[model samples]
Structures are given as structure tokens and as C-alpha cells.
Target: MKTTLTSLVAALVLAGCASVGTVDPAQLPQAPAAYKAQSANGAAALTASWWQPFADPVLDDLVARAMAANTSVQAAANRLAQARAALGGAEASRLPQVGLAAGAGRSSTPGQPVPQPATQYNAGLSLAYELDLGGRLLHERNAAALDVLSREQLLADARLLVQANVARGYLALRALDAEREIVRGTVAAYGETLSLTEKRARAGDVADLDLARVRAELAANEAEALALDRRRLELETALAVLLGEPASNFRLAPTAWATALPAVPAGLPSELLQRRPDLAAARSQLQAAQARVGVAQAAWWPSLSLTAQGGGVSNELSNLLRSGAGTWGVGLLAALPIFDGGRREAGVNTAKAQLDGSAIAFREQFLLALKDVEDQLGALTLLQQQGEANARAVSAASQALKLSDTRYRNGLVSQLELLDARRSELANKRAALQVRSAQYQATVGLIRALGGGWSSDAGVKLAGV
Candidate 1:
């Protein structure tokens, strides 16, 4: 009866000891149900190869090359492999460690006229296991497993970033190409205007000052065209670096302006939460930190280790395995912390602090994701409106230039008026192209905000955490 009471008391004490730190995820802030942009029922779904929707074969090829050769992508893959190996190591702690040992040695006595000689041989297998009665080993394994998931998700995130960057670079290149064409056209028009003005001056129909102004305009246009060429070359070199090639060895064909941007679907909140690798990584890190807390708390409890060894020994190496010349033993040891200069307590405190830090980080990530989605949605909407406005402006500017040229031929407008109209028309056309470029960039930003072409099923398969 007394023994039963003692067991009950011990069980109650251990139960009290087990409840140290607690974290309730429900207490954390929740993510919004949907992004600011609402899609129609026919909204397109996001694909892993999202950049392909632009239909730029060059961009498609570039993304493929970057995935295969980019240094950052390779580094993320290596990190994932390392995480997997570390998780395996953590799991190994749960099983018994067994080893075999064999040895032979001879000893002699000193300070004797006739030396006393002895020989010994031994061979045995030793087994040791630390019983995880409090689930410390399992918790540590759980933490390591979560770390592996975080790393794999991080790898996915890295790939997504590379794809988005390639798409952006491709779009910028095309936008610059359009601008260059506009500048070249302006240069040609200005050269014609300068010739007309010089011919009029030589005939005494216009003053020499008019010819000088036209020539100055021609020089300015030529300089602008040269600047555009420099910018385009710089973009080309940047793209080559992204593709892991030398700048001199890489080239891109002219940009494809006719390609349509890919439309993305508005997935349900549940799917979005699961698809965003960064969010998943944050959650995994939190779980890992939680497990670490348990591991730290377990340090306060006594540890039980079981060790056993059985082997044969003989005076001669030949009889090392003989049954009669054998020795065997087993040990059950318990270790309780006596004194460690406050190291263990400090560890526990550090783990608790880390748990708090992880919780804050997870919440911060969710907030940032929400903000990104909203910002991109607003940006896409405004960019589309701006693109339409730019188109109308380009059309009006073209009409004004045509009318001005006709007026100049009829002697109703000055040559300067014609020149101004032509320059305005050229600037307006380039601005229109910039609007289209902005729309493409906005689409890319929205895709990135939505977590970059992830599939729920794929996320589940690749990141089982």
C-alpha cells in the first residue's frame, strides 16, 4: 500500500514537470482570405512555368538556363541536402548504438631477475542506448525533420525568385528595344527636317538661324539614340550573368512585343497558405523552435542509459573467441544534474527566448505577405488604366504631327512648329511603349506576390511538413 502511494506521488510530480512552455497558434494573427484583386470564375491558374505565358521563346530559354546553371539555385539545393542529412543524424539517436572491439596485448614485469610475462586477448560487442522515456529524442527528431522541410521550401522559393528575375529582365530588354527604335526614328526625321531647313536657307526662303536650330535638334536626337544603345547593351550583359555565361558570349534577339502576359487565378486562401514556400518555411521554423524548447526542458530530467557487453578473452589470440574464456556484463545508469555552473539553466532560458523570437517572426512573415499581395493588386489595376491612357495620348500626338506637317507644306505653320510636333509624337510613342512595359512588370509582380507559380499538390508532395 505504501509503495503504491509513492508511485502515484512520483507520477504526479513528473506530470507537473512536463508542462513548462506552451504555444497556441490560434492566438496568432490570421492571414486574409483573399488578395485585393478579385478574379472572375474564369481566372487562369498559376503554373510552375509561368514565364512561358509571355510566349517569348527567349525568356523561356533563359529561365531554363538559369535554373540549370545559376549559382544561387545550386547553393539552395546543397543546403536542402545538408538539412536532410542532419535530420537523418538526429533520428539515429533513437536507436541503440552497437560496436565490436578486438585486441591482443602482452605485458612484462620489471625489477625482476626473471621477467614475468603475460598475454591477453579480448573481443566483444558493446551496446548502449539512452531510453527516451520523456520523449526528448523524439522531439529533437521532430525539430530536425521540420528543419529539413524549411530548407526544401527555401529551395523552392529560390527557384521562384530566379524565374521572376529572368522574366523581369526579359521585359526590360524589350522595353528598351522599343525605346531605341523610337529614338532612331526621331533621329531620321530630324535629319530630314535639318536638310529641308538648310535648303530653304540657301534659297533665301528661311534665315540661317532656323537651319542651325534644326541641326542642333538632329545632334540631340543622335545622342539620345546612342544613350539607348548603351542601356540595351548593359541589360544584355546583366542577363548573361544571370544565365551563368560570360557577357561577351551571350546575346538576346529583339524583344517580342506582341506576346500577351499570363493571367493568374485567384486561388482559395487555404491553397495559398499551403503554396507559399516562405510561409511554410516560417511555420516549420516555429515548430522546430517549439521542439527545441522541449529538448531544453528535458535536460532538467534524469537520463537513463543502458549498456551491455559480452565477449571472450584468452591468454592467446587463437583462443580469443573460446566460450570458456569469456566475460560478460551489463549496466543500468541514471544521471541527474548535480551542478553545472548554471549552464543548463541558461540553455533553457535561451531556448525559451528563441521560441518567442520564432513566434514573432512567423507573425511578421504573414503580415508581409498580406501587404505584398495588396500592393501588387493596386499596382496592376493602376498600370492597366495608365496603359490605356498612354495609348490615347500616342494616337492624338500622331494626328497632331500629321496636321502640322500638312500646315507646314501649305505655308500656314513655321518649320519650328513642324519640328516640335514631330518630336512630341516620337516622345509620346515611347511613353506608350513604357506603359506596356509597366503592365508586364506589374503582372510579374503580382505573380511574385502570389508566391510565384506554386501548385498545392506539388507543395504537398515536395514539402510534407
Candidate 2:
């Protein structure tokens, strides 16, 4: 009998190991060799802290603060902790459970002898464990471990997104500041032009119509400046919220614009699978789903469990300590499903459907990641060209405004022509500011799309904690 039992245990162990399913990495879709929209000059590798390239200390501080205090990031961290705890519980389920019990009770029977009441006292230790002959427990534990990893990746992704949002907000605020300054300068220039036109009109060298035009131009420039101020206030308030502060209590002083554009390297697309935290999370989820499928499949087999209890019982409390009163027993229980009204089949089908959904989600995430990088690359390339052209236009407009001013003073051109030149110069300068703003926005966008740098192994290291 002993030899037969040993052989049966060994066979079950081998069969359990053989029954576990495997997932092939090659079964997943492949990435392209190169990005279609990557620029020739975008060969510089990105660093872990991609925002540092902008050389803005305030921006760096804002991003750090947001990561630490943002509500969304905090929520993600909490979810990660929950996943870790769940994994601990799943692992514990796979091990033997030992419990101690002690109790005292009194009972009476109506049809018993004269001493019908009796007192009972008991103390015991109990042990129970699943044999895991079908690998069900192991598969569940594996799935839970993968779930923890998925939550970790999700937390990292949240941090990445928060950092990107802070950078974008800060850069936009700075761009608005720069644009406001340009408008202010234009308003001042228009004021001086109005003064000169009024003097010319008083000296009978200019008509009343010319004076009215100058006044109208001044009013328009002033209105534009006011509009810019309103926008700046709105942007400042929004940025304060991103910093996790009340808008009324937060303020950012006007400062020099940092429009430095960082070059991002277009690495092999396959590397994205590792570098992108969202993709990493998706892959982890897929692994967990695959493990759950195995668990469901294992349900078709029988479950084996072992239980044991050792204790002492007696009518007298002192007698309970005596070895003669001791009681001990062991048991081996096997539960085989004969008929469950198709419950097992439904469970297997559900697990398979979930596995299929996870697989598709992972593929979709990969494709979206590729699209993000390509879109940013295209924006960066086109914005660079636009910036160069805007610079040239600003310079030419300035020269034309100067020539028109001199011609109007000499009566060689009408006041309308001079006003037109001024408007053109201002428009060109404002357009140039917009182009610079777009370039900064695109640069930050590219950094975000590239998974906030190439630090593929960068993650929340909570191992010791």
C-alpha cells in the first residue's frame, strides 16, 4: 500500500507539471523596423528625466511636486499597494494553514441519567492544505504575482503622464507670457504713432481722417493686449491646479522663455515593448489572463486536500491534560466534479474569452504607442521648418515698417499705408511667438510619446517596503 501511494503521488506531480500551459512571446505581433516619420537628425538618446533638457528649473520643480502630490498619482499608488496585498494573500493560500482552538461548553439531555448536565473542555491544533495535484493553486498564485507587476507598471505610467502634463502646462504658460510681452510692446509702439499723427494733424500737415485712423489702431492694439492678459490669467490658474495648489494662492512670475528643443532618438520599435510603461502593464495583464486560463482548465480535474487534528477532551478539566484522554486523527479528502450543471464549462469559456480580450488589448496598446511617437516626430519636423520661416518674416516685416514710417513723415506715403505696415509687423511678431510655442509643446509631446526616456527598467522599487 505504501509503495502504491508513493507511485500515485509521483505520477500526479508529473502530470500537474505537464498540464500547465505556456505562452509564446513570438506569437505576439512584431514591430516595424523603423518609424515612417522619424527625422534624420533625431538620433540623440533620451534620458530618464526628459524635461531636464528644457533647462527650466521651475518646470523641474513643478513636475516633481505634481508626481509627489497629484491626486491621480496617489490613487495609482494606492492601487499598487492593494495589488501587492492581494498577491500576498494568494501566495498564502497555496501553503498549509495551521490554527489553534480552545473551548469550554455545558450541555444537558432530557432523557439522560440523573447527572444529565455535563461540561466539556477542549484544546487542539488543526492543519489543512490543498495537495495542488492539478496545479490550480499554483496557477492562481502565478496570476496574482503577475497582477502585482501590472499594477506597478500602471503606477509608473501614471507618474509619467503627470510629469508630461506638468511640463506641457508650464511650457504653455511661458509661451503665453512671451506672447503677452510682444502685444504690450506693439501697444506702446501704436501709442507713439498716434501721438505723432495727432501732432501732424494739428500742424495742418495731416487730415482729420488720418488722426481718426491712428486713434482706431491704438484702440485695437489696446484691446488685443487686454485679451492677452485675460488668457494669461486663465492659463496661470490652470497651471496652479496642475501643481496641486489653489489658483488664488498660487502665482508664477513672468520670466524668460526657455524654448530649447531636445532631440529624441527613434530606437528599434521592439524596444518600445519594454520602455513604455503602458505597454508593460498591458503585457503583464495578458500574462495574468493566461495564467487564469490555466486555472480554469485545471477545474476539470479533481482537487485533493489533507487535514489533521490533535487534541484532548474530558469531563474533568485536569483529566484533559492526561495523555490517555488525547485524541488524534488525519484525513485525505478528494473532491471530483461529477455534474455541476455546466458551471465548469462556462468558467473555462469565460477564462478563454478574457485571455483573448487581453491579447487584443496588448496589441492595441503597441499600435497606439507607435502612432504616438510618429505623430510627435512629424510635428517636431514641421514646426522646425515653420519657426525658421517665421523668423525671416518677422525681420522683413520690421524693415518694411521702418521704411513706411520714414515715408509717412516725409508725406511720400499716406497714414493708412504707415498703419498697415505697423499692423503687418505686429502680426508677424505674434505669429513667430505662436510658432515657438508650438515647437515647445511638440518637443514635450515627443518626450512623453517616447515613454519619458529610455529607462526601461525605471519603476517604483518597493521591494524592501
Candidate 3:
């Protein structure tokens, strides 16, 4: 009987290794060797501070402030803290629990001993520990720890999003500033042409219709400048929100758009699984779900626990500590679910479903990450080509405007012709600014898609603000 009991205990100990679910990174979908839209190869890996490549100090400052103060970022940080606390709680559960108890009471016997009253005092220390016979506690702790990891990755993702938003906003603002200047320059040129036409009309060298046309063009140019101003204000206010400041107190002075576009290396598709925080978070969540399945499976097995209590009781408080009044007890308890009407089976099924869902979610995340990189790469490539064409168009339009102005002054062309040339030049210039702005935006997007930079060692770091 002794040998049989020992064998039974050993088998129960081995059963603790059983798990209901498993996750294999290798089982995940594989990535392609190269992105279809990639135009370059063998570039350096992105840095953790991806925005620094823009070479704009102001943009760098804005990104830092957003990461530090953005509401979403703060919320993620709080969640990470909560997950850490939960893991701590789960770990603490695996250790023995000890408690102290003390009480004093008075009681009276109603039907015996002449209705005498009695006083009692007692103090005791109690201990209890679950034996983890089927690895339930271990699986629970593992799940909690994975939850903490998931939250940490989510926080990193939040920071990456904030940084990308700041960069985009700043780039748009700069582009609008450039467009505003172009409109203002066009308005001034039209004003000069209108003045020249007025002088010619007074000298009877030009018709009233010509003067009217120049005046109309001048008014339209001024209106366009005004519209640009309104758009600039709107973008400024939006940026203020991104920076976590009141719009009334925040302002960005107009500056030249000199931001550099950083080249992003299109690494292997597998690298994305490691670099992207969202992917990492998804992976952790899947692991946590698998661990929970183990927990559920363990519920079908018996739970074993140990308990002990030592105490002393006496009628006198002073004698409570006496050895003669002492009492001690110890116990080993095992509980097996005798009847729960399929509750345990239901729990197992639920856990299995959750695990399946998590695996699907992880695959979806991976696919989306791949799509994100591809989209950004395609945009950057197209935008670069468009920018080159726009630059050429701007140069040609500028030359045409200069020639038309000379012809109008020499009385060889109508004021309307000169006005058309000026408008064309301004439109081309604004279009060029827009193309450049889009390049910057796409650069930021690609960086974001690549997981907000790379590290040589342990993937991206979440420490830098």
C-alpha cells in the first residue's frame, strides 16, 4: 500500500507537465524575401529615434513632447502598470500565505452553572499553501506575466503612433507655410500688374477692359492667399492638440521646409514579426491565451493543499501564552470535482476557443504589418517621382511668367496673358510643396510601419521618449 501510494503521488507530479495548448512562432505565416514596392536594397537599419533622421530639431522636440504627454501614451503606461501588479499578485499566490488572528470574548450560560459568565482570549498563527499538484498556479502566473509583456508592447506601439502623428502634423504645417508664401507672392505680382495697367489706362495706352481684368485677377489672388491662411490656422490648431497644449497658447513660426527624407531599408518579412510592437503584443497575447488553456485544463485535476494552525486559549489574558493552554493542528486536503454538471468541460472548451481566436488575431496582425510596409514603400516611390516632375514644372512656369511679364511691359501681350502666367507659376509652386510634404509624410509612415526603428540586439526599445 505504501509503494502504491508513492507511485500514485509520482504520477500526479508528472501530470503537472500536461498542457492543453501550444504556440509555435514557426507555425506562423512566412514573409516574402522582398517587398514588391521596394526600390532600394542593402540600406542601414532604422534607429530607435526614427524622427531624428528628418534632421529637424523642432520636429524632434515636438515628437518628444507628444510621446511624454499624449493621452493615449499615458493610458497605455497605466495599463502596463496594472498588468505588472496583476503578475505580482499571481506570483504571490504561489507562496505560502500566513496570517495572525487574535480575539477576546465574553459569554454566559443560560441553563447551567447558576448562569455564570465566562471570558475567553485566544491568539493564533495559521499557514496555508497550495501544492500546485497539476500546475494550475504555475500556468496562472505565466499567463499574468505574459499579460504584462503584452501591455508593455502596447505602450511601445502607442508611443510609435504618437511620434508618427507629430511628424505628419509638423510636415503638413511646413507645407502649408510654403504654399501660403507662394500665394502671397502671386498676390503681390498681380498687384504690381494691376498698378501698371491702371497707369497705362490713364495714359490711354490700355483699354478700361484690360484694367478691369487685372483688377479681377488681383482680387482672386488675394482671396486665394486668404484661403491659405485659414487652412494654416486649422492645421496649427490640430497640431496644438497633438502636442498636448492649448491652441490659444501654442504657435508655430513659419520656417523653410528643409526636412530630409530618410531611406528605409526593406528588410526581410520575418524581421517585421520581431520589430513591430503590435505584432509583439499580439504574439504575447496568444501565449497568454495558451497559458490560460493550461490553467483551464488543470481545473479537471485534483487540487492539493496544506494547512497548519497553532494557538493558545485561556480564560485569563495573561495565561494565553502558556504551554499548558496551547493547541496545534495540521491538515492536508485534496479536492476533486465530483460533480459540476459539465462546468469543467465548458471551461476547457472556452479556453480552447480563446486560444484559437488569439492565433487568428496574431496572423491578422502579421498580414496587416506586411501590408503597411508595402503601402508606404509604394507611396514613397511614387511621391519621389512626382516631386522630380513638379520641380521641373515649377522651373518652367517661373521662366514663362518672367517672359510674359516682359511682353506685357513692352505692350506685346495683354495683361490677361501676364496674369495667367503668374497664376500658373503659383499653382506649380504649391503643387511642388505638396509633393515634398507627401514625401515626408510617407517617410514617417514607412518608419512607423517598420516598428519605429530597429535595434541590433533585442528588437526596438521602449525607453526613449
Q: What TM-score, computed on C-alpha atoms, does each candidate reach? A: 0.91, 0.89, 0.90
| Preferred candidate (TM-score higher): 2 or 3 | 3
* Candidate 3: 10-residue stretch with minimal lDDT: 456-465
Clashing pairs in 3: none
lDDT per residue as tens, model 3, 1-465: 999767755554454456568756566756677777875645566567878877899998898878777888899999999999999999999999999999999998798968889999999999999998677899999999989989999999998888888888889988888888888888888788878888889999999998888888888888888888898899888878877888999889999878877766645454653568888888889889998998988886788899999999999999999999899999999886556887877888899899989988988887988888889889988987899999999999999999998998999997778878888898899899888888888878877887875444435532210
- List, residue by residue over 18-47, the lDDT tens digit for candidate 1: 754556868555656666665333455656
What lDDT score belongs to each candidate, Candidate 1 first?
0.79, 0.80, 0.83
The per-residue C-alpha lDDT of model 1 at residue 227 equals 90
Which candidate, 2 or 3, has the higher lDDT?
3
Candidate 2, residues 62-159, lDDT tens digits: the string is 88878767888889999999999988998999999999998899998677567588899998899999988667888899899989898988998888
lDDT assessment of candidate 1: 0.79
Candidate 3 runs further than 4 Å off: 1-18, 23-27, 41-45, 110-113, 265-273, 454-465
Looking at model 3, residue 144 earns an lDDT score of 100
Q: What lDDT is obtained when candidate 2 is compared to the true structure?
A: 0.80
Model 1 ranges with Cα > 4 A deviation:
1-16, 39-42, 109-113, 264-274, 454-465
